[model samples]
Target chain A: MPHDHDHPHSLLPPDPALRVKALETILTEKGLVDPAALDEIIDTYQNRIGPRNGARVVARMWCDPGFREEMLKDPMPRLREMGLYGRQGEHMVFVENTRDVHNVVVCTLCSCYPWPLLGIPPGWYKSDAYRARVVREPRKVLAEFGVDLPGETRVRVWDSTAEIRYLVVPQRPEGTDGMDEPDLAALVTRDSMVGTGLVPGPTP
Target chain B: MSRVHDMGGRFGDGTVAPGEDAVFAAPWHGRALALTLAAGALGHWTIDASRHARESLSPRDYARFSYYEKWLAALADMLVARGIVTEDELQAGHAAEQSSLSERALMAGSVAGVLKSGSVYDRAGPAPALVVGARVRTRRPARNTMVEGGHTRLPGYAAGATGTVVRLHGTHVFPDSNAHGLGEAPEPLYAVAFEARELWGAAAEGDEVIVDLWQSYLEPA
Candidate 1:
């Protein structure tokens, strides 16, 4: 490994190849990982099946009331029922969004979210600011995300600890009242079901 | 070492930076890439390794692993864009670890030992404090910002906020690192209800907003 201490003068630094190589060497020496094996694992997970599976399951739950109820009571049964059980969502709760009230879920401890339903939680949910602020000042926190609810709507913040994982079942919006299940399904955004946003119907 | 997952709720309220959630808006592949890099950096390779491997870890360990998995997945995208590491390299490393990484990976990932001796809430039994409808006041710390420090009972959003204990949900193991390991004894935790005005300003108007706060975060009004 050649050291780069002897050179410099130009404003632009060289590429980070050396640093990457060094890191790779260190990881290999420590026996922390095998580079070849790692590549295959990453390729399969990243390119193959992804959050789409979880998103579809959530979409299905949004349209099926009975399934949604089962998901709320014990998410695992319904999740397994739907073959969507795994990852961080072994235990789950589906919070229903209703008129006059909205449910926003946060893992105040460390982002214990329902990955099986909504997929991985957004980074903001795990940050110190979100975990801390959302539980206390939810309206304000929601406001920052462009999710401003009138003060009249009560914000119920669920702190997901270890035993339970939660998902927000957003209220079905008005314009989609007469729409069929599949059309209504398109209206369910992961955020809305997470209680951070509403499922707005298709543009008039 | 204190696993970040084991130290939940340690930071006092208000420390979470604004607009942090959108960072996870990337596509699933990007998120997976982020997770792999994080697992490598933290020396915890089993989180997303596979279903069987994950099941082998204890509940506490599983909790920490899950936390890291979410963190890494989100972080990988940022790392790739910043050129800290390449997508190919990150992926390759993850795959290598999958087949050959040993039990050390599991031990290296353990944060169970770092958990505090007693949890603020009892994960094992029942919460030991004010029940729903019990009158309680927010515990006013000497400094409001202290609430912003690492895991505390008080929620940053609820500091200076007051309410009646609305529900006495059964004892939940308090997530605070300082409180995680408390043995068998029950600790008081409460689900308090606060008026929207109390959390926001007077201009706010809504039915009372209910939050599940621990007993440590409250005081007698």
Candidate 2:
């Protein structure tokens, strides 16, 4: 394979894919990293952990009054009880979105999101546009995402600057009565838990 | 001075358009993320140090690189800076010498356990200086600049702003010190709520911004 600096000018690979390949190769040769370990890490986030884990929590909250109250007041213990704690989720906080107030989260400095609960952050969540705009004009940003709120609903933006990870518990949609846990969980979208969108009403 | 990564409240970046929802938009993205995380687990440097490397990129590069590009670039920088790899070696896409640092290699079997038990930042420290509901003011950076040669969690927009402490988060590792070679000086953390109007005056809308701030960044209002 021709190296990035094969020429006298010393140019890096123009393609990011090539650069990533080079890095993995170099790290593996140095014995600093294992390729199998890398694959395992990728598979874990890409498959096992994601918003589905968070949805189950949301559905339970809708069904059990005590669970919802405890979660809003204190989330870490409740989350730990369900074995839903890990990296990027060391310290968890639950912010409930209500009719009067809506809560959203962003990490302006870097993309600090709840990886264990929601998996890798969506591209928009990590984009510079979202980081810059959401803090200043969340109402406008939310509207762009097809989420328009009443003028009276105050918005609260949580800038995650520390180890504490926040999970926005969107209000349970109306007419969800008699639905089992899995049934209710199916309605919870990733956007609702992130506070960009709300859970929609059940289909007639 | 604030870096390009400290983009909170600044304007004209662009519109917030959603993109493909896949965890990894490309195969290389997954490889880059995994490589960064696996290398980081070798106990080479603190997570804060990694963050500083990514933020320290030139403004042009910062704007140009994608999210995972930044991660891979920062990882390479850290590897070279720590003498684990040479610039020539990186450019050549090969290692020149075997590293004696393989003792802490994150093996495949240990990957799950390592991620399962993530690094805990909480440390035993003195009681919190401020309590919930306390009125406090965030201290501005020196000469309106961030910590010289050190990293900080305090964003520029929140500098010198007055807000109420909404919640109390116990002592945790301080990024300003941890990012550098300094030890983990755990400090009391608080979720301070500042009215949108307070931070952004007339430009502000009817909303509030809550930032998790360390005790050292706050003083009695």
TM-score top scorer: 2
Q: Between which residue pairs do clashes occur in model 2?
A: none
Q: Which ranges in model 1 have alpha carbons more than 4 Å from their true place?
A: A1-25, A34-64, A106-112, A123-152, A159-164, A175-182, B1-101, B106-123, B127-130, B138-150, B157-161, B165-169, B177-191, B200-203, B207-211, B215-221
lDDT, candidate 2, B1-221, per-residue tens: 77889989999887886754789999999999999999998787998999988987767778888898888878877887787878788778888877899877788999888877777788999689898889999988512223574688889889999999999888999888888868888888999999998988853456899999998889999
lDDT of 1 by residue, B117-184 (tens): 11122356643656566777776541222223333434445566678875555565443433222223
- What candidate 2 gets wrong by more than 4 Å, as runs, is A1-12, B142-147, B203-206
User: Per-residue alpha-carbon lDDT of model 1 for A1-204, expressed as tens digits?
Assistant: 222221110111122233233334434544544555444443433443334554565566667778776766666665666666554555555667777778887765445566545554566666656765565566766777677786567777766533455667777677665676666667777667666667776789
Best by lDDT: 2
Worst 10 residues of 1 chain B by lDDT: B111-120
Chain A of model 2 scored by TM-score? 0.92
* lDDT of the candidates, in the order given: 0.50, 0.86
Q: Alpha carbon lDDT of residue B139, candidate 2?
A: 85
True contacts kept of each: 0.18, 0.76
